[model samples]
Target: MGRVAGKVALVTGGGSGLGAADSELLAQEGATVIVTDVRLEAAQAVADRIGGAAVAMALDVASEAAWQQVIGDIEARFGRLDILINNAGVVVMADCEDTTLEQFRWVNAIMTDGVFLGCKYAIPLMNKGDGGSIVNMSSTGALLGYPIFFAYSAAKGAVRSMTKSIAIMCQDKGYKIRCNSVHPGAIETPMVQEASGRAGQAQAVPDGVLPAGAVGAPSDVAAMVLYLASDESRFVTGAEFVVDNGLTIRP
Candidate 1:
């Protein structure tokens, strides 16, 4: 049951959707979780529900100051960080021709820049102990062309590339930290529901076996996150894991 026993993990956007699921699973496996989100109350709610060594903090990923503050707090409180999940993101529903510069920059700042900062700051802390793992949440959009999610696709693409670079760097430098990216397609999360115009509607899929292009559950992606966060993936690094119900392979 203790897949990540005694580890100290930090999850960005731990308030809801995939983030909440990740935090819950990590804690279930015996890790002390720090849940951070732009919304303090949301993060706090998740933390309270989980209850234990889990705590909540407000963090604006795009701001260096906020990152510094959260990391500093972690250093002061826990003294070591074992897992970092860069999962916070925002999407703008606009194609290339219609997307404004502001929209593009906003999405990239949160997803792209946020992942960069998380890795940059968390590595040194992880290096302090037995190295750790970093999981960046990319999307199928990064692999396939997503015209309607222009900025999101761009940001996720950057995340995918950056994950590989960070993994290689850590390896070359003799660091034990491993970095990987996850590409999830059409997960049934609040963000996806709202973006797809099904926010308040029920989504039905087959029980035991999902169809080729059915939307997946948050647990599907969280399972991958759990594996990456655990020592079970000790030999895995610089890899891309896709949990899209085979949607990316359809002709």
Candidate 2:
């Protein structure tokens, strides 16, 4: 227990799926977690489940004002921020040829722009304390192009790139902040399930997506976030951690 004892963490999209798992585990490890999601009720549910170690807040990641308000509230209440997990995202399936500019912009607004805003606002606050860990949830799609999820892949790719840039900037400036991105593949989450259904596939693997005999759970990704959020990975920054069960590897 107490893997992140006394730390303060803000997890965007903490209402459900991998975000919920991360929030619960971080609290179990003794961190005061702020679970923020656009869906206030869902975030509240997560906080209620975590008891005293968590609080639910409403945050529209695409809005800079919302980000400022939430961060300000965290500073006032917690006095310092030690961890920021930019996990809020959406996956929309549309071929490159069919995706409209509006669609692309919207996807990037949430996945790409949201992370940028979070980092921009949270960095100075994090620097105020002992510095902090920033974990951005990229996907295997970021490493490779998925024809059906073109915009999602593109946005996540930007996230992967931006994470490295932030990591190096912090390192160069001598800040103790460590920034990293996580690439998850075919996890059994609602978002993945929705994409699978849209692709006319069952919940089970559709051949080439997930490797044979490979399966993933929210806890799989959450465990990696826990390590990154903790002091155990102090030397790690500008790195990509793949929790995709070798799905990105080709024979």
Model 2 over residues 55-119: C-alpha lDDT tens digits?
Answer: 99999999999999999999999899999999999977898999999999999999999999999
Query: How would you encode candidate 1's per-residue C-alpha lDDT over 59-100 as one tens digit per residue?
Result: 999999999999999999999999999999999999999999
User: Over the full model, what C-alpha lDDT does candidate 1 score relative to the true structure?
Assistant: 0.95
Which residues of candidate 1, in runs, are more than 4 Å off? 200-207
Name the candidate that leads on TM-score: 1
Predicted structure 2: lDDT: 0.93
Off by over 4 Å in 2: 198-213
Worst 10-residue lDDT window, candidate 1: 200-209
Q: Output the number of the lDDT-best candidate.
A: 1
TM-score of each: 0.97, 0.94
